[model samples]
Target: MKKTLNINIGNSIILIEEDAYEMLTGYLNEIKFHFSKNADHFEIVTDIENRIAEMFREMLLQQQKQVISIDDVQLVIAQMGSVKDFENADEAEGGIYEETISGVKKLYRDTDDAYIAGVCSGLGHYANIEAKWFRLMFLVSFFFAGSGIVVYLIMWILIPRAATRSQRMYMKGEAVNLHGFIRNFEEELAGNQLISRSRGFFVELAEAAGRIVRTLGKTFFKVVAWLIIILGSCFFLAMLVGMAVFLGFSDANPNEYFPLNIVNDAYLSSMVFAFFVALAIPIIALVLFAIRVAFNSRAINRTVSFGLLVVWLGGVMLSIFYITKVASEFKEEAEFSQVRELKKYDAYTLTLDRSRFFSRADSVKYQINSDKYRGKVILNDMDDPYNLPRNVRLNIEKSENGLVTLTQNNSSHGKTFEAALSHAQNIHYDFSQQDSLLNFSPFLQLNRNTKWRDQEVTLTLKVPVGVKLILNEEMDLFSYSFDYWSCEDHGAPKAWVMTEEGLKCTKP
Candidate 1:
């Protein structure tokens, strides 16, 4: 029977009996003696203390003794682990930053993988919680606009990363076995554990066989990866050059942006170039991989893997950055304007007549003429000529406020439509009507192989509020790319054919 003394670990309080306390004190004295000459007396002592406390608790549980006895304390001392294990298991997480650490579990700011702050993910990982829950909680706290991101950013800027080796390893999901270091070592050796498949029968066999075969194979692959890396580099560079020239040509001239012309063009060009560049690197790597397979190579080089991993990580990060930027831009703008508004105003239509705009020069008029352009207008995609865009439509709506709204829509398959929408966003294209004519302008387009937009337009012209007129388009406006027209006494025709003289006639 013994009285108890309290010890605290983190937020948890531990009860130690008088007998155990005395015994623990004796063991501590021994450790102090052994580390007497060490410079880190504080660290050594702290580690030993935590280990003593943990074992004392374990003893109380196992022996069903309310008090930790001197015998139990002696047993703990007997269980006193090697310096390495003691250091590891009982090591105070030593704070997040080595320079600023005072104790374990220091809350340091993390600035990785976040637009504002990766606080949720980082902290979740540190605390062993699901990142999703943190994100939900963070979002819930703000109620709207995800304001927790800002708080996280603040935390990131203020917190420091775990400094101690042990702390850092824990942050990265590694365990620290300070008290069991030697025991674990002995256990591993006794069990003949294959921690890394190293120095084992199979490992030795593999090492020998691989050495004889892989050296040759590795050499061959190194050569191939080198070639692919070079060739892929050249291909990507060439695509860049071509894009630059085409964009320069388009900017120097300019083209008609009807129903998002520039966006369509730019989207097409950028996507084609990007696809070529993106796939080239992967393909080149794959080629090297194939060669490696043929030659019977093992894993990729650590350096090469590490380098590629960094590059891929960078790409993902950059993509997130850009997406976040764009999403922010759209946060304040969400309105759908109808077409038909622009028909009341005098508008000009620039014809997109060139085929293969993505790969062919002068495929669009702007490329043939513009000097203010940043890139060529490339078509994002087209259905098979046989399965061409159905429910494809164009309308000019005159709003009550004298604003014209022109809308272009297509009823295509979901995937194909998504591709088209992606093209529109990538190229910076949007639709709005002003003055009299519907201004269809696009920021970009995507390249579509084997499928092309057909020559047909559907049109519905809307007159301005309280405005009416008679108009003439050279051709009946069903909806076509180029409808020549001339107008006299009339409001603009929602559907009109372009005439050399202008809108020629008017209809109800």
Candidate 2:
């Protein structure tokens, strides 16, 4: 049957029982009477009253109570203390006051003088240190580890704001009782000169500039995080699709031309899986962290973050080890050389046959060596021996014995020289003779069981003096230097004769 009354506390509206209101009003009047003789007595009493109002609002909000009760008023008085307690405290017992702050220190965000969320200020008060030191520590840690931003944001969310003067007093390790409370109220009323002594105009200006920079930095990091999340997600999804289509579902996939095919199928799968794990986990973690920052969500646990880091590190190590294993397969090399005797001939024609070059119906078939040289010839049908080519190059020189000799040199690479030699010997080329005419195969072929190991062939023609050699147009991009000019640059057909000096181009 108790009547309720509406009251304003620290600009907040609150409802309280009539009895509680009377008790609070009498307690505040008593405080005002005690500080009556002081110069700043009015300011001190006003501050204390405001502190009581703020406490009332906090209790109502925290307890979900509809109206403040007498019990609630008495509890707040016990926490803040009565005016008589300050009068009883002695000032001569080797201290400014015999009474000390009895309430335990509490963490609270000091909104009165805060830069961003008052986290450093709250932490400083709780730890009994200067706030600027905490700020400096955060700044240094930001440059070194980037953990400061995360920690600051987390603290901002966790620490409650010091909405009441009593809470603020407790935050600074001051007693919430009347004696210590009066001292703090008077200090605050005294214009806060102690804290503001070092804060000049330049300090305020610098703080303003820092705020602008901090805002810009936040925006920049947001954009960067979004980009990393989106791009990383797209790339990770593409890898998954590729793996599913090529490795997971396909049977007898003929796309053996892939560079990863150098390793065994199982090892390739392991490597790709490791690489995907190495890339995807960090992307996911970073995206999650970005979302937390943008939304101000709960911070990730340290244990979980550390676990993800360890997993990413393991994936990286696995990928590097497997890549090294694959590269080692091409370390050793072997070559094959053979000399074939040619019948008596006054001249010889070095030509690559292109009879069915364009007759293939499948135009989209994976054609090797599809690149052009100086915009002249597209060496599509002729493989480049530098990367497992099926084509061979020809070199001509004068013979010492006045006889014609054709020497073929083939080379290949593998994990061992014996394996390389086996691969090199597997290369097949056809060269047939008809009286004075010698025909050579345009492309070399690898045996069905043989794998590509950068296999290539070179033919050396030992021509006698006065023997003329004609290079056909099909050998345009396939041939290297024969005379002073490059045979690959042949506009039309060219003829060269072996002399005592060297092979000389017959044309101007």
Candidate 2 structure quality by residue, lDDT tens digits, 1-508? 9999998866677898999999988987888788897889988877877888888878888998889999999998998877766776524223323224346788997766677667788888898889999999998989977999998866765577775666787788785665445566767866665443334555456456546667787787778777876786787688788767766754544334434445656576778778887888877787777777666674577888889899999999999998788777778999979998899778777666532232122222344333422233233444323324345777877899977998999988888999888878887766777776666677676543245677778888898899987776656545554543543344766777789998877862
Best by TM-score: 2
In terms of lDDT, model 2 sits at 0.72
Cα lDDT for residue 66, candidate 1 = 64
Poorest 10 consecutive residues by lDDT, candidate 1: 448-457
Candidate 1 residue lDDT tens string, 1-508: 4578885733346776776676666666767776776799878688767777677677778878666566776676667754556567546454235333333343432333332334566677777776678778887978768687567544544454443444454455654445244445656665785443223454345335434554666577677776765676677677767667755676532223222222234354444444444444465566557556555674477788667656655655554554454334333311222344344434443222212223332345224544443354435333222222322344434444555344443211112444433433322222443343333322123233212222222344443444433222322323433333333334444333334333333344
Error of model 1, residue 122, in angstroms = 48
Q: Could you tell me every candidate's TM-score relative to the true structure?
A: 0.24, 0.48
Backbone clash pairs for candidate 2 read none
Against the true structure, candidate 2 reaches a TM-score of: 0.48
